[model samples]
Target chain A: MQHFLRKTVAVFESLGDRSLDSFERLGRSTLFLVRVFKSIPFVFLRPWLLIQQLYSVGVLTIVIVLVAGTFVGMVLGLQGYNILVRFNSESSLGTMVGLTLVRELGPVVTALLFAGRAGSALTAELGLMKTTEQFSALEMMAVDPFKRVIAPRFLAGFLSMPMLAAIFSAVGIYGGYYVGVYLLGVDDGAYWAQMQKSVDFHEDFMNGVWKTVVFGFVATWIALFEGYDSVPTSEGIGRATTQSVVNASLAVLGLNFILTALMLETS
Target chain B: MTRQILEIWVGVFVAAGIAALFMLAMKVSNLSTVSTGDTYEITARFDNIGGLSIRSPVKASGVLVGRVSNIKYDKDYSVAVVTMSIQNRFDSFSIDSRASIYTAGLLGEQYIELVPGIEDNYLEDGSDVVMADSALILENLIGRFISEIISK
Candidate 1:
């Protein structure tokens, strides 16, 4: 009885410590996010740095986005075609695929991929710079590392995410077409006709654009915050990279659910 | 040299995204489907307009002819008034044509389907389609089934 009581007390104590640690981290992250936003003017001042970061973060990730997008779209086409066929409404496969991709899967998938690829890379790069005392060196030279190093990368990530997501969606629609029209023998005209009749520009497509913009902001903010706050060690760099991806993904999904509910309720 | 290339690539990327968005608007969204060509409006009255709304397609023999332009409740007749815009090309529908609300599939959207009669004269603009059939309400059918079972 004494041992059990002691174990229970220890568990509660650890839980309390974890909650307090999380709250502190949250406060620090919010401050870091604000500081990053404040440094946006610096990004514009040195447009070269923003361009360099955009190339590294956005351009480098294109191949993966294209490949993942094509596969996702093909799978959706196959599955949607089969299900719609069951109801003798296979002609609406285009509408089903288009709506599903634009409304939900497109933004969500792009955000997750960006988190895993660009977010982790950002965390590692910053964490390594911190571990090597490079930030301190910059401070010695009277350079604000936040303005010079972090701002451009954060802005690039924010800008690139929406564009990458749009490209993914476009490629995905073509993949769906390849499967549904070329392979499954669904009527080409009916597919496109149904899509036009059903999908609304403001309701579906622009809503997706809105979602990606929000996701880009949240994911990049998390990535930058994790890296800036990383403990100055090799292990800390590794941990920060992993945590950056995981946290960004969770934030994207949670924010998606909330945004979806709000968008639906209002519209 | 690399800076110029990267700048060009970024411009191309932005342009591609915009192009895709424009294609989506043209191909999938209803934005481009609004008929700006010549069309005439007509009204129909029904007792129940179940699952019907503006922008629903107006079809004749499985061919889309126009769209429902507006819907209103008539206080004097205690009926639903539905206005449809028919294209000029499909102006051959007769004055005695019957308009019935129908579902595309078992659980699909409702549309107004017109069946032409043997009348010599064609329907004019601002004319009423007097033989309007109301929509089939599924709930009412299920309730009737349950009541019949209880009585039996």
Candidate 2:
């Protein structure tokens, strides 16, 4: 019993040490990122990273955004019309649709969609690389894997989410317009004019963009961290992929709350 | 690689063009003014404006002809002074044109519906329309309904 207790204590101590080491590495990595940012001109000069990011954030996820935007818009319009007709106040359809799309739906839905697409792909790619000892080979050759492997994805995710968010917002508003004017037979002039008047472009647009950037960072960081720290087996790769998606999704939601609070307080 | 790059560029252009067209359609549908020959202004006083905001459509017989330009409080009268810009083509709006604050749909928006009067004399600019209906406040209506139910 004494020997077992000692063994358990030793295991706990090793875990504590490993956690401390992880924290230390995280601090060093953050500092490294700061240094990299200082040399951002050189970083931006590399077209490969930019193209990768654009592809990840914009081109690859086009179908998801298109489908999500259309459906959400349709539902919002249909529901809004039902509620408005109850009070015979159908003219406010534009305001309802515009506000819903800009403030909430645009950022949240786009990020969720991105998490499902690029988030999963990123995790799988990184996990496979870690499992195959590719990362070990890079380290053996004295290549900084973080810079070569992780940084491009990090930068891409950071850039891509906001661009995707902008597309989502624009398309969503149009979808709402389509349902409101054509299907509902609401006066088109009234709908557009009210939307234009109520929605302040800066507040909605900038807030949406800012939220997406934070979402991007959280999604990329969690996925990469899971992939990098994965156990050395096939089962470990599977576990890491699952954990990556779960953690990234949770982080996205938590960060969204924090950002919304900050924006409200500052505004 | 070059072909792939060209394809991406084409995709980007097409996406941008589609977005621009949608924006253009929305703008043209809402902002363009109809030339109604003679311009007239009518003032309607209401206790509450509700969702009667600026540039909200003013419809007559389900046809949009003008818009509510402004809403201001009449300090002495304690009423909302709503100014509507009507096109000149509907020139026969006499003293009896009934203006009602009505909503487009349930959970939709509020607009003023103008019922043209039979009197031949046209309303001059800045003239007050005598027949005006106050906007229905949703909360008040609900409260009144609940109270009635309780009383019964």
TM-score of chain A of 1: 0.97
- lDDT (Cα, tens digit) per residue for candidate 2, span A93-207: 8888877877778778888887778777777888889889998899899866666677777776766676666667677767877888899988888787777656644455457
DockQ, all models: 0.50, 0.07
How well does model 2 score by local distance difference test? 0.74
Judging by DockQ against the true structure, name the best candidate: 1
lDDT of each: 0.89, 0.74
Off by over 4 Å in 2: A1-42, A140-142, B1-3, B6-152
Best by lDDT: 1
Candidate 1 lDDT by residue in tens digits, A28-105: 988888888898998888998998888878887878898999999999999999999998999999899889888888
User: For candidate 1, lDDT tens digit of each residue in B31-141?
Assistant: 786656888998999999999988788999988888898999999999999999999889998998899999878899999998989888888789899899999999988
In candidate 1, clashing pairs total: 0
- Candidate 1 regions exceeding 4 Å error are B34-47, B53-102, B111-133, B138-152
- The TM-score obtained by model 2 is 0.61
